[model samples]
Target: MNFHELLLCEGNTLEKEKGEHVFMQGDSDKSLYFIQTGLLKAYYTSSSGKEAIKSFILPNDFIGSLSSIYAGQNCSFSLVSLETSMLVKIPFEKIVEYGKKDIVLANNIIEFLMRLTLKKERREHEFLCMSAEERYLALIESTPILLKKITQNDLARYLGMTPVGLSRIKKRVQSKMSKQGENNP
Candidate 1:
């Protein structure tokens, strides 16, 4: 079967409304999901009930399979729709079994996982090394379009900060830049 057809046959198509949750933090280890359209934000809720955005998946982005494929583990995060989303949910067992037989699917899964791993590693490095201003600029530069679509709260969470904290950081950066501009101009 073709990739899309295989996905359709093996998975259930789901439509999630905006602000509606697709899966909770500790849902099930049953199935995986592929994003055919729209956006999803994966997050972890802290002890203080603060939701931190781990990542955002856009069109053609894949999800749910990462923990299953890479760690043989249940989801470490919750997934929620940022907007109305169309997703294909595939059984985890079916994916593991299919990977044994289909070279195309196996390669696709490998490539997708590699990309995900690299992204996560990059974020880890940034978290440990980059300054707050540098991190904010890097995020803005990476997803320039997202600046408008995503909320400040979500962006703050992605940066591992509270909304108020992010606001202060933004103000500090702006003030510093403004002073620099005055000095130069």
Candidate 2:
């Protein structure tokens, strides 16, 4: 089942401008959000204020401080819009209230949460095992649309590479693609 459908039916819709923070680090809000349009980035800020991009959330994806919500603590990461966006914001309390009355909704929420966890785990493994070029190529293969939507700096950060490094990878990939096209032609 599409989790966004449930969110759209039950949650409050909110519009966010580009560069706006949906929820900042250390925020106490436990509201979950489903992106309906545009892009968002989840990031971590170090004590020295260096930002590290964790993930770029696209439309139909969910974003929130999951660990914080589970732990009853403040959010550890901030979610900011990379473009003007629309989102369905669902309060955690409301989810519990609704879940008590609906078993299917409860199961769907559990399944969605599990899928998120598994995706994160897969990404972690990829980072540990994949070269920077391989990681970038995999991203291109999986989410090419993101290349158009996100800034090079943000994409570099998401792939755990410097902007210059990412540039080199892009050049290499493009050159390879061009060579393949010429050969086929």
Candidate 3:
């Protein structure tokens, strides 16, 4: 079954504004939220008073349910709407009952979790292996739409770079692209 149908069957839609939180770290782990529209970022603040992004969720993606899958654990990450977003919140009991009743739904949920995990892992790896410029380019190449939607500061934080460093990289990338265009012309 499709996402809307699933939501229609057993979930409620929530509307939230940009900068509003869907869930915070240490909140109850009783529900799974699916993004029907817009975006959400999962993050955690360190003891050093730093915020590190864990993952970004776009439309048709799931968030916050991972910690609940194995056992009901306190939220390990904060989920904030990056834009005014629409989310379908499904309670754990509803999903568990639905999964038991329908194999296809269970399979879909499993696949969704696996997809999210893989993407999160890739993001972590990029932070480790890619230079700031490379990571920035990769993000741009993958989600050019986000360039207009999110602030450079958030982008810098997501890429694990300082905002000033991001500014320098942005200028360099722009200059390089402009020169390439001139040369080609």
Best-performing candidate as measured by lDDT: 2
C-alpha lDDT values of all predictions: 0.82, 0.86, 0.82
Q: How far is candidate 2 from the true structure (C-alpha RMSD, Å)?
A: 2.9
lDDT score for candidate 3 against the true structure: 0.82
The Cα RMSD in angstroms, rounded to one decimal, for candidate 3 relative to the true structure is 2.6
Q: Write the per-residue lDDT of candidate 1 for residues 1-185, one digit (tens) a residue.
A: 34566787878998999988877776655677788888889998887887888889888877773564457676678899998999998877887788889898888778877898998899999999998778998887888988888999899998888899889989998989789889573
How would the candidate models be sorted by lDDT, starting from the highest? Answer: 2, 1, 3
Query: What C-alpha lDDT, on a 0 to 100 scale, does residue 80 get in candidate 1?
Result: 91
How many clashes in each structure?
A: 0, 0, 0
Ranking by TM-score: 1, 2, 3
Quote the positional error of residue 7 for candidate 1 in Å.
1.3
**Cα TM-score per model:** 0.88, 0.87, 0.85
TM-score of 1: 0.88
User: Which candidate number has the best TM-score?
Assistant: 1
Ranked by TM-score, the better of candidates 1 and 2 is 1
Using lDDT as the measure, name the better of candidate 2 and candidate 3.
2
lDDT of 2 by residue, 1-185 (tens): 23555676779999999999998999888788888898899999889987789888888888889777778989999999989999999887778777787888889888987998899998998889999999998988888988988789988988888899999998998999889889573
Model 3: per-residue Cα lDDT over 13-102, one tens digit each: 999999999878877768778788988888887878788777678897777646744566778878898889999888877777878888
